[model samples]
Target: MDMFRRTFAEVNLDHVAHNFEVLKAAFPNTSFLCPMVKANAYGHGDVAIALCLQQAGARHLGVCLIEEALLLRRGGVTANILVFRGFDREGAEQLLANNLTPVVSTWDQLEALEEMAKTPVKIHLKFNTGMNRLGFSIEEAEKLFDKCWRHPKIQVEGVLTHLFNGEDADELDGDSADQLGKLLRILLVFKPLNPLNHSLNSAGILNALIVREQKNPQHILNQVQWGLRPGLMVYGFNPLKRQDILPLKPVMTLKSVASTYRMLKVGEVVSYGGTWKAKRDSVVAIVPIGYADGYHRILSNKAEVLFNGYKVPVVGTICMDFLMVDVTDAIHGCDLNDLRDKEIILFGKSDQGQFISAEELAHRAQTITWEILTSVGERVPRVYVGDWAKRLGVAN
Candidate 1:
């Protein structure tokens, strides 16, 4: 056990189930609940998280790349997997053969996909609704829809668009409204072309209240035919800033253990930069996790980890395989007992009942909740626990 490094992340599947239930309750009318599981299911391990989500009644799974879809197919995930990012000609056949849906963003991709062996492939045409990242323009989208509608080998399952300013709570503007309006206009141009028309993400749905109260409601949400595509909310992170108003829970809790402990004199510095100096005879604990392990280097001396039920301040520069925490106050009595190999709560919770929320960690890191979840390194072992875990055949 010592050879394996006492540190590993424990993922709570119960929280994941809770998060799924919350999303289900919020959007009871959703036709397809596609939870994004790309980037190793946001570092929770793709197979494990996808299995857990599938058990929790997730009908569809979303991944960023074709390889991710292939990985899931190989892992026995039979659910309808949608490749959010459309692929090129090289990967289109594999996408079709594996029964994976690609969100076609351009006419060239659609043309490439058309040349594949004549198997009716389900595809979602991504409309460039303000994000300007992917998807087709109004004219291009119309032409592609017409072409695919006429083609015998292609089955257009959905027409989707992403919101650009969904996260912003302030300015209740109509940019999103206009984008949705444009999508509808494109849909109408290609008359009788109705394939699961959807245009909202977690932020879009969460921010629907704003759209309802704004100048135009019909233009933004009323056009959605299929339902919503919620990624973050399904994983238990609130997409809107007004999360206090709506009940949402975080699904993943990243937990690791403390591997070693030491005592440092008053003037001694810690780690690579020697930036952190001990103010007093402090007890320092080293966690076998660092930047190389996905713990951001920005959190060097600014972060805190829960140890022995207490929040201990992290000291010194974060190295590749370890980080130091000032534990003088934490070493008094009960907190100090069995200090060596004691579990360290990195970004989740402690055994003694202390917890660090992902939102808090994201704030400290000056990034988004998505980044925090996706940044979790591969080395950390994921242990799924709860009803969903049991249903997925993962041990507690």
Candidate 2:
């Protein structure tokens, strides 16, 4: 069905490909680039993005659950999907049936694999260096090798870990470095098993590049083939904000049009709590999107959006299905009819050359870019665009 509302998100598949190319070029030593598509590809629509990346030559993809992996398999994605969340017996069976790989983090997960495997199954072993969230701790290395790695049904295809602070790779004694040191030590124990080694996410990938450029043969990171699982960077937001390293074009642009306008007199308040009272005559554009649509309520009267090539302040409490923008200056010379066809950009570049990034919105909301991107509401239709979209017959 076509979009029923003027509000939607435009996803550029070309930008996705460009970002992939940039990442590949930045990390030439990377054996594979596993694009994380969890949380609906951070709300950009997973199936479409996965298909785009697969067409772009991605051999591997990452998702948080077997259900997500199954979604991709059903969507015609043929890449090697690594399910981050460990599975139960039924999930393990499904993984085998779909040719999906599972990351074994806990012993119970290993037991599930052992219980479900009738044939040899490839798996990535997750070791906890410092994150303390998931994975087998480093102290459990010898026990894992002895108990699971040698299990006949379980084939150790890769060894992996999460770097708690990849942004600190510059400091030799920093948390990231210390974590890498531990990972490399684990690699030493698993080297004979011949598993792919990976620990870096987007920030870690950039750090890997930094360490690579140094060309120090003695660096702890040079121990094995580096497989990177880049999450945010692939979708075009930099974790460390280092665009100079690899310039990334944002894939998703959230946009909407003013549904109608309201003229407010001085001292007249707006929205749920009368939080924003106009100090003078104001022209407010009522946008057809709100907190329910993934626009955060904290952004009420705190964020700005691009309207008619100008920055307009968001006014009043953001409602469940609407938001109000003060566009007095933006509509100075244009008739209301003139803006009927214009778009108001919540984030990403506007055709008129003005831009508002997700990072900017995240700052306004006192959150991170990841939360901002993933929080985009499921109800907001994702309008796919660009070369891949055209080829895939999903272009808008």
Candidate 3:
């Protein structure tokens, strides 16, 4: 497939590999470093990102669906792929065929797995420790395991939970601690089984590290094989938006070119709704990207794009396929004719070493960095670059 549009997302694979190592160092006790590659690697091209991580020594990977695991398997991801979403009978059959692990949290899922397993199959038991979204309750898990009714073919490989308030350090000592305490009690039931235990996400990992430094480190983590599954941080964006956190690089740079240039007179209206009127003679650059491109419509007149290392306001209402930027001040950096072909950065690093972070862009759009990255529509081609690109046999 050929990408004809100038508007696209550039993914730096090296940054991803670097981030993987940094995250591993942060969670030193991680027996399994499972980076979530679901939602098409958060819309950053799953296959490429997965392969890069696998090469960077990721022995395990996490996804949200059976189909997502199958995609990675097809893409030559030989690592242990754990499907976070529990499976049914039909989904269980595929798991057996593909050698994929399912995170079981429901009786139906257990029944389905037991009925389908002719050979031994490994599964992770998910406990609901206040994150009511998924997983069985502590009492439910205790009763289920105590019954000793698990299929001989069904093997419990790990016990895991989600941290609902992992971003706040105080919550790590309170709510997250309560959650882990529940997970710890569950761990006792499976102690003889020796299953890996994990509960920290991106924010949880950072907050947990902070708690470890401020107090004695080896309480819940000392006795068991622990795992860390970081999603957003794997892509090099800070989930907590703290400057003191890991020094990770932004992997994807959303960019476009100034496709058309126009000189707007004072009082002249621009774009739909005419919400913005030129206060002075302004150099308007029509960037070929809009709401359909994952650039939020609400960012109509609030977002800024980088032009020649200068931040230019996105003036007027953003259209379905275009947005107008006032490049009058930016014109001082380059000639008007030169500006037409100049690369405009929506977010991430530019050729001139200037960088615009997705964190800032998401903030301006009244959203989060996760949404901003995944919201990038499939229409935008993902151009893979970095030292690992050629190693992955990928090209821009």
Candidate 4:
């Protein structure tokens, strides 16, 4: 089946629906659910994931760039797509034309958006809420607010900010508090305009207690703004390390099959760099996926894949098209002969109770959940399963 040339990420629409329900259950009062589908829906295939989310009651969609949003529109998704990373003049005009909302980060970009549109453009004014990566500064935010108030063609639909230190609940740094406070201050400046003021991301929503402790608990959530922009949480990964938290099913399961399996003699080296050698006679299975396909080289010798409900240790350096795993002492019920061309669970569950989780791989890679999901390369085909996939008639 040309396994080496083809790797597929099995996306469970049922999991997506479950994740959406979890988010809804957590915050039933939330007005809009902005499921971030940026980075090709975290490499789960943006169009397919968006459809699944939309079918699961997602009213708003979030993307990293203008092109991503345009891709969704081209794919027949007609939801309110929000470009999280604000765009430039041409991009802004394109967004306006397609009825997509651009999160304006600067006064010039906002002005540029204002100039291109014949009709009013809905926008979310992003403030520098400590991430300091995007968004307008406090002074710039005030100026943009004033300008939007004056401009008849620019409608400030929302005001938002991102939290940088959401992972550490106990250490809710002064910077995040200041950023939230700054956003609140900015919101007051434009209160007469009644723009949707929101300052929370996945971490903010998950760590509401931290946010509440710092600022006015009532206003930070229910009372004050329009809604929260939750991305990772909606996708079913816990951003915060809280105790006894609600379980969230991971929406994407990246998997490939074992194309070749062989036994290697002791002292024999495997893969590139000769970093790993067999201590004894070992049965090695080659999985048809690698770094180029987003299996990640960093996971070399540190990751595990599931086969026949058993966890197999990944050995040697991960290659561009394959990686070797030690399957000599696989758990009971594992049949090496039957596993050839059979599905190898790289990061998802199997019928026999084997599953590789994105969170576990992310920890091994020393990165975030977002990076792990987004890094799944384009070559890996996506198989969507569940009601959304059935309704859309998208092939597995």
TM-score, per-candidate, Cα-based: 0.92, 0.96, 0.95, 0.91
The true-versus-predicted C-alpha distance at residue 145 of model 1, in Å, is: 3.2
**lDDT ranking of the models:** 2, 3, 4, 1
Steric collisions counted per model: 1, 0, 0, 1
Runs in model 2 lying further than 4 Å from the true structure: 148-150, 214-219, 222-225
Q: How close is candidate 2 to the true structure, as a TM-score?
A: 0.96
Report the C-alpha displacement of residue 211, candidate 3, in angstroms.
2.0
lDDT per residue as tens, model 1, 73-175: 8888989898988777888888878888888887788888878748777788888867889988777865676687767878888877887876652243467
Off by over 4 Å in 4: 1-6, 168-174, 209-226, 331-336
State model 4's lDDT: 0.77
**Ranked candidates, highest TM-score first:** 2, 3, 1, 4
> lDDT per residue, candidate 4, 288-395, as tens digits?
899998888999999999875678899999999899898888724466666667667888778886667788889999987788888888778788777767877785
Stretches of candidate 1 above 4 Å error?
1-3, 169-172, 209-219, 222-226, 334-337
**Candidate 1 accuracy as lDDT:** 0.75
Q: In order, what lDDT does every prediction score?
A: 0.75, 0.87, 0.85, 0.77
Structure candidate 1, residue pairs in collision: 258-344
Better of 1 and 2 by TM-score: 2
